[model samples]
Target: MAGKRRKVPHALHSELSEYSSLLRALSTNDTLDVAKRLTESKPRKRKKRTEEESDGAAENEGTAAPSKKRRKRTEDAPVDAESTQNEAAGSSQLPEEEPNGDKPKRVRKRDGWTRWPLLVTDLRVPEFGLDEEIEALVRHCLRNNNPHPTDEDGDSDPEDDAPAWLPHLTQSSSAFLSSLFALLAHHTPARPQVMQDRLNAIDWRMVLDILATCGSVDADVINTVKTRMEAIYGPYDGPAPTRLEARAVAKSRTDAALDEADDAMFVAVRPSKRLPKRVLEDVDSDALDD
Candidate 1:
């Protein structure tokens, strides 16, 4: 009975072979279906193979000899698109740093000249006594009507007829006058326009008095101050008296006095050659008595 069991093909043998083939075909089809499903998925899962597993697989496949284990490429790893774009936008919007490291500085403007205050100390007269002399001269010139008195014949005024109160400046006084004039000549246009403007804004009489008192020792100095004052006050050609014109008048009077003195000296030293015979006779008579 055991020998027959081994030799005789049972009716179930064909069915069993068919079942085995079908099972193999089904496994292959199932494997193919799994692969297709994986490809069609929206999000794909990457296969994670260990280094040893990959190397062993490659050896079994008869490919090139396995190399050293490679480090994963994290630098180029896939990132969320929205997150990456948000990061980039945030970095771009950051404010830049200033190279100077601080806020910018500001500049201020200067005030005009008229803003400066005057002090009482600046009003004191100089120690040279020039202020008194200049004041006297100015007063005399303004008050005295006849600086030079003419004879009835309209001839040159006699030496005695000259004004009594004419300004007779000393050598020191003359030097001061020259210096004042020089100062005026040099600084008339050089002084800042603002200073002139300030001067003009003040009362003319007060300004003139201040200048005259401050610069009395020298004519030149006085003139310089006057020139500055005039420039501010607009050319002072009006009936109002000016230092420049006063200086000129004073100079003329001085020259005339000098000329008269010279004439008197000449007359005293050199008697007239054409004197009358009677006058000569009287002189000879007196000489004989001496």
Candidate 2:
């Protein structure tokens, strides 16, 4: 089943609101606003001679300390661009703003396991505990540094490296597995597979058969996942292959070994005959005490 495609959204509704507010603030800073900002600094320097010169001098550090500080702040803090001028303006008239020396509060995730850092703990399950190395693989997925389709040098570019995190905060430690292999461990054991491997693993005829009977998932979601799987890896060639099992055999393994031992040998006396002529294996005549 083919899923109806929709255009991708660059940002979410919640993010758009914040971005809109920031844009309004930025857009308002026009030629006159720039002129006012430039002219405003010099007056502040002269204002140091005022009655409150000692206190005012601190505000007159940078030619325009507030704007400079705000730009510097972007490295460590979320620029509250909506609170554009008045917040970081650093002017004495604006009530000397306190320095935000602290780093920006990171956006934590609801699942308790964060995606931003892509920790193995995010995928934690009981089959495997939190492994720190999974974070690197998650990072590799998030890296958008893949070469452009048109680039002649695309083939030459080596893999990229970078970090991004949106950590889940609500994860329980012992309750669940923190590993990707947890789900399919018994059979399919999900992990990175090249396209050809994916093709081999999947049995498309079985997919259609199961899809007809699968009632748990919405048809749309099933289509979406199926389409995504097909797009990433070519379709499977055959239906699921049969898995052969060993025939049942009695008296195997531990019980068999124990039953074979002379001291622990299993003896069966028939009810009809009561006891056989030789009730058990004949004892070694020479070894037995006379």
Task: Give, for candidate 2, the lowest lDDT window spanning 10 residues.
Answer: 240-249
- Quote the lDDT for 5 in model 1: 44
lDDT (Cα, 0-100) at 51 in candidate 1: 62
RMSD of 1: 47.2
The Cα RMSD in angstroms, rounded to one decimal, for candidate 2 relative to the true structure is 27.0
Position 43, candidate 1: lDDT: 56
- For 67-170, candidate 1 gives per-residue lDDT tens digits of 22112322456567887788679868988543333322454763333322323322334476665656556556644755654466247434434445544544
lDDT of each: 0.51, 0.42
Estimate the TM-score for candidate 2: 0.17
Give candidate 2 regions above 4 Å deviation: 1-133, 141-165, 169-183, 186-222, 232-290
Give the per-residue Cα lDDT of candidate 2 at 128. Answer: 42
Per residue, candidate 2 scores C-alpha lDDT tens digits across 1-290 of 99998855767766776676554444333312434543453333322133355345554653467578767878777756665566546453665444331223455763211112223322324454343335444545544555344455455443332222323321332123432123223223243444322212223344433433423224455456656757644674432211101111222455666757855455664677566475687779888967
Clashes per candidate, residues 3 or more apart or on different chains: 9, 19
TM-score for each prediction?
Answer: 0.19, 0.17
